[model samples]
Target: MSTTSTQPANSRSRVITASLVGTTIEFYDFYAYATAAVLVFPVLFFPSSDPTASLLASFAVFGAAMVARPIGAVIFGHFGDKYGRKATLVASLLTMGIATFLIGCLPTINQIGFWAPALLLVLRLAQGFALGGEWSGAALVATENAPAGKRAWYGTFPQLGAPLGFIIANGLFLLINFAMPADDPSQKSDAFLEWGWRVPFWFSAVMVIVGLWVRLKLVESDAFKKAEAKGTIRKLPVLEAFRTYWWQMILGTFLMLATYVLFYLMTNFTLTFGTKPQTLPEGGDPATFVPGQGFAYTDFVIMQIIGVVFFGIFTMVAGPLADRFGRRKTLIWVTSAIVLFGLTFSFFLMPRENPVGEGTYWMTLAFLIIGFTLMGLTFGPMGALLPELFPTNVRYTGSAIAYNVSSILGAALAPIIALALLSTGGGNPWLVGIYLSAMAVLTLIAALLMRETKDSDYTGDAGEASASHPAP
Candidate 1:
């Protein structure tokens, strides 16, 4: 269990691969669902008289998954903290994979009536539940095995999964979109709605198999073994986490708030807004029209993919910066930039005189690149910062709770709120920008309150000192 400087090279490689691949698969499954929520589910599953109503209903199901995440965090965190990371990680990946595959095979509302959306919600919650455990475990696996002075750098490996997954999932959808027979290059073919959209969901099964294989090869980290040897493993880690580290939990949650808000806004809300028509259709009533910067779905997705490349790059860049400058200082600077970025949303996203023209397209693409860049800077450090807040004994529980709890406050509400704000602003994105700015301010406060955790001892456990009895 001891990590020496001369740990086997393959062992280090396996640790990075397992942690990265597991989260890559988990995020792929999640992103597949997210893309469908915007494109297919609103029409196929919700089917309301109003388009906005249908989209809202679809987003509601998406947000419902966030509601289940905290519960998942508690359940998975308990076993992860008590038993070990390996089995719990495998279980979470399997659960997420199965749920996503079944979603691909589901009957649409037209075929199954009310049962369609009902079944979708169940599977969505399962995905959320699985992910609740997946991230924290993966972060632990990477950081716990890190060499001296490189925990932050190692931590970025798992965080890389987000952009990697986004690219793969969205790229697959883009390919499928192009392959389907359609008169217009930008619009979805009827065939896509009926079947093409399901391919990404089913593809998750194959990715999960690879992830499981990698994870099964993992050994418990040195930190976990040390906790076990010292009899620091608790019978009830969740209770102990809340009892001892509640303040850290609160700080960690808010620290993640702006990142979640920005992420969902960039991926989910932007997709919805970008694809909406800039002008009313011929013979349509002006009173009922909602203006948007109408780009074709395919075009906008390509734009998003471009921006996500910056997301991936900055994520890696954040790790080294955090390692050098400290997590708190790096996050404070990045979060402040996010605040300024939020203020510019309207300038970038709003419709121009010619919404779909070449000039507007370039501006929107710039907006996406800048937003995703800031997202990367803020999101990358979380893998190290959150886990560093708690000792090894309760680290899994404490970090998972904070991470997923923030999901409820930020990811769960961001798209729904942004959409409503769009409606409130009459399709101008300024109100949505204000919402993001407000959340970033909260995150800034949390960052200000948090102590620098760059130098925290990863292998120590304060819980052991307080324990009346050790695990036998």
Candidate 2:
């Protein structure tokens, strides 16, 4: 097969569909866990001796997957570079689907003692491992088959999965949370904890069936086929990637800093912050007022669902914009905007004290809209930009390493770090904002350093892949 971007229309559509569906299912699984971590895990899994400690424990389980991502990248990248994108993609989807379904079946701390959290951690790691491999395969297939000026647009199909997954995950969790209500403030809601949370996890088994049906239909990326035909496949892509493309791996990880920081702060940190009882300021009496803003948890989830829908729309818009403005340039602008968003996060929307009026409601909406809009613009181009940094031979290994390592640095620990900061500052959000701003600066510098790869040739091999096969 020719590796030319001008493939048949039917194949192109199938490739794009495969990419979008697989990526969507992967993200949906992830975001669902994140939402649950804030709302359910603390109560169900950890020692409730201290609120902050339990919350930290929940986040640690969440971060466990991030820790596994780079390892998954190495393992899966080898097969993707040697076997084919389609097979690796299918396997990764099954890995995630099965892990998620199992998570639904696990017992809570009350039912199974320590085994509950231990089992949950294992499944979380599996989910992380599968996703580490999943995104790169989807991205590589889409871009490799796309026409020259259209790779960025094609790339967004996979990136678009984040917000689409976010909406579905948040929506389901929201509905589940609503199914059981807290009729008395003195007691917790066991209805949701007992059974409502399990519904989404079991549904993942069905989602896996759909994702596999679509992904299994995908034709291999033309670029990979071209390399295999020319006898240029490598057996040990991981070593080759490190030896030749270490700089790109490093820079790509740094370039993703702002995006990783922004999302965890938005979704995980905010939920924890909003729902945790607000500490009374010095000299204030608790007898006269409610602790925290008293914002409804389900209402906040609804707000997030609406915000994520726009997040998806802007991600779609970013595809065409990147094709026109240049990937590097567009990323630089979007990241710079994120810096401004970080600096103003508290001033414009979140109330420093109890929000007693309608004005605070509008401010809260403003905060989410601005943050997600910027998230959409910046995230859309990443799928195209990361793979473009490497040649076809090491593209899978290189992009996988860079993308997953950044997850460890940013998303993996973001909620934990933000919680510590919040606890230290007595619930002040400024520390978290500062952390987000610093990451945006790193992202800006990285964008400035990277070369524009929108027009790079994907059909060529990198200096004869050693051994016509690297060691497996």
Candidate 3:
């Protein structure tokens, strides 16, 4: 702890808090757009004749940010590795905050037509760019500042942000939705479409203010500082990262794919699938009521919030499990479970072919609990695992690229794919489940190839300093 002049003995806790808070704000901004894509973007931004086409258009623009994430990783990673983690982190937060707040101010299709979606695509890119730099920096700060044998446990704090962000994002959406006339079938939703959805995006400004305050309070992380002191920091971390750890990046990308697939499927895709109005029955019992049709938006949010609670619980459990069982092994088991869960998604998410009314809501909640529990298991160890893949010098660049690459390949396209499959099958969750299972298997293989890294020395000069002081 003596390596720093400004920080006190509680530096580890401070670092964890800062990382968690910052990432929460980042994901909150992210899911806010995701929720809007389904609930409002189709009606507000992409006006279309066919309702399916409109939703798909909203999802395509939603994918734009995922595409931009790797680019953000490059820009932020260069500066983070070149200068310091603290500065880059603060910059990322401000960038996302500004972009998200502006999204609230943008006009809808009624006001601007084509330019509405065009401008939205641009801001979504900014959001992705900012987040590309965020998670890696946050993860590193927590793990680098952790105690000897508690990297996974400390790392969980930053990992904690995903579910926390889900809760906060949906919690706000649910509250705002409650205040509006979204559920009223009497054609009273003009206020909701016109102004209600924007409230969440506009609220991000206040969140960013608080996030920046916590992040600014943080000191530089010990791991990055140690490498810098020894003159081991690389001038070009991107090239060096690929040269030394290219294969690791590929494997890390796949390792994270299952988790990303798991989340986006349940959260984003389900938001769209569960909210549309029902049409002519394709081939079902005429008596069975189809779920997720019109005005079910708030109900789905409530279901997701319940799942978030379970995700939070298992996320805490996952950290300790990873610490004891080893990171690679923990990931492998979780990925396998994800595969099985994906295969069984139809049974869990919908008990009957056409479940109607309150029973359907209970079934949806059950499915979310099952899916999100797996999400937590696969996701919680990542803050420790990704940074362990490369040495301290190129850690930020390596992990950032790998994390966001999975975003592009898996999450960036999930809702679009899910909706496409549903539109083809006349709303079939089984096809979406099969898509998830395929990605999960790929992730399982990547986990198999990776070695346990919990024992690696992360201090300096290719090895840790021998047992200096225990964790704070």
Candidate 4:
């Protein structure tokens, strides 16, 4: 893409494609590691004395990625704001692809002794670091290309990448499982850890090329151009975020807390807890899942596939909803729906025997729909909302800091905390529900306090708008 702000139809289309493709690739790499952490890394990399402890350790490594995210956000946000969105995006993609590919090449615990898990952690951190920079850059690309009246709609184009990435990731894993022999569980798992796991990570290399091709074809945003023209750009974008946009950043982080926690709970936590027989009650094993016979990895995988499909559907729906209903209202309502989702499905989805066999399957489907639908509503509008919260001079850095730092507070500890709650609360998954609800409640409050910014003109004076709106 050219580095000019010419509003050609071709330019807009190219920018949207660039944002969608890049974000999709970034999320794919990030979620691939998350899936591995839950399903394979515990056994392959971190071998603990207890199975649960091993899984916990794996989740900790997963969280390691989230922990590194803020640091990456700061570094990339600075360069993205100072240099440009395109440069930071390409660099982040390269970093993520290299880290993921190296992970595919790492030796298992049997081969490398203590270095196996250490290597896994190192690669995982790199993945987090890259992802931290990925979202905001992608968001900037789409919104910048968008017309004045349709920024949220265009912003949502990149948000679709989240669901699209999940679909591709889980669909690929499901395909691999189906291809493997059913009778040889050990052989299948061994192959998966030894080689099968590498396929998805290695595939990310192709995306880097695809993303670059699309991104390199797009023009920079009009807002950035205007900022550059006025010589109003910050020397230290990240530091400016801390000094001026600190309150907005804090509120944005908490505002996102519910969505992030619900995400891990629905995707990673459910997969882990659902597969373990012990997580289900003694006599209430649902027909769909037999705790002792076998936990339903395939079933849950299928559910996630279904979930991603709806997630895309709902994402499309949310754009117009925000346009019609206002972003804050949409976000508040969506978050409240998530709270109810947790309440309803927390216990209902647990494998339980009823007059009907496999009734929990329905519960699983219900939760999947509910979780994904709510995610679509809030996440779809968030790209526009966060950037609109700040001026163009500080937009890249300020929005990125809010987005990734929130990942640290919200998602980084979710799996660990949910598991701990499940383990300590006599295995009552309801406790996990409460935790999710609390985050949603916090987000609701933050949403209430936040000013609506849908009408803000990004191409005009962002500082003037900021003065009028004021940061919450």
Best by lDDT: 1
Q: What is the lDDT of residue 16 in candidate 2?
A: 80
lDDT of 2 by residue, 1-472 (tens): 3433446333777878888999999999998788878778888999675555677899999999999999989888989887888799999999999999898898999999999999999999999999999999989978887876888898999998898888888888777766677785322478888878878888888888998999877777657766776666776778888887899999999988899989888788776665555555445444422234445687666767777787888888898899998999999889989888888865754555556356766677677788888888988898899999887777888999999999999999898888776655555577788889999999999999999887777655543645444455
Q: For candidate 1, write residues 1-472 as lDDT tens digits.
A: 3446225223789989998999999999999999999888988999966777788999999999999999999999999999998999999999999999999999999999999999999999999999999999999999988887888999999999999999999999999988995787546799998899999999998999899999999888878877788878888998888877899999999999999999999999999899888877666666656677888988999999999999999999999999999999999999999999989987887778898998999999999999999999999999999999999889999999999999999999999898888888898999999999999999999999998899987776546754654433
TM-scores of the candidates in the order shown:
0.96, 0.93, 0.91, 0.91
- Top candidate when judged by TM-score against the true structure: 1
Candidate lDDT scores, in order, read 0.91, 0.82, 0.81, 0.78
Cα lDDT tens digits for candidate 4, 235-276: 777766777789889888887888798888878887876666
Cα RMSD, model 3: 5.1
Clashing pairs in 2: 235-470, 236-470
Q: What residue pairs are clashing in model 3?
A: 274-292
* lDDT of candidate 3 at residue 354, scale 0 to 100: 53
Stretches off by above 4 angstroms in model 1 are 1-10, 281-289, 468-472
State how far residue 90 of model 4 sits from its true place (Å).
Answer: 0.7
RMSD per candidate (Å) reads 2.1, 3.2, 5.1, 4.5
Candidate 2 RMSD computed on C-alpha atoms after optimal superposition onto the true structure: 3.2
Candidate 4 lDDT (Cα, whole model)? 0.78
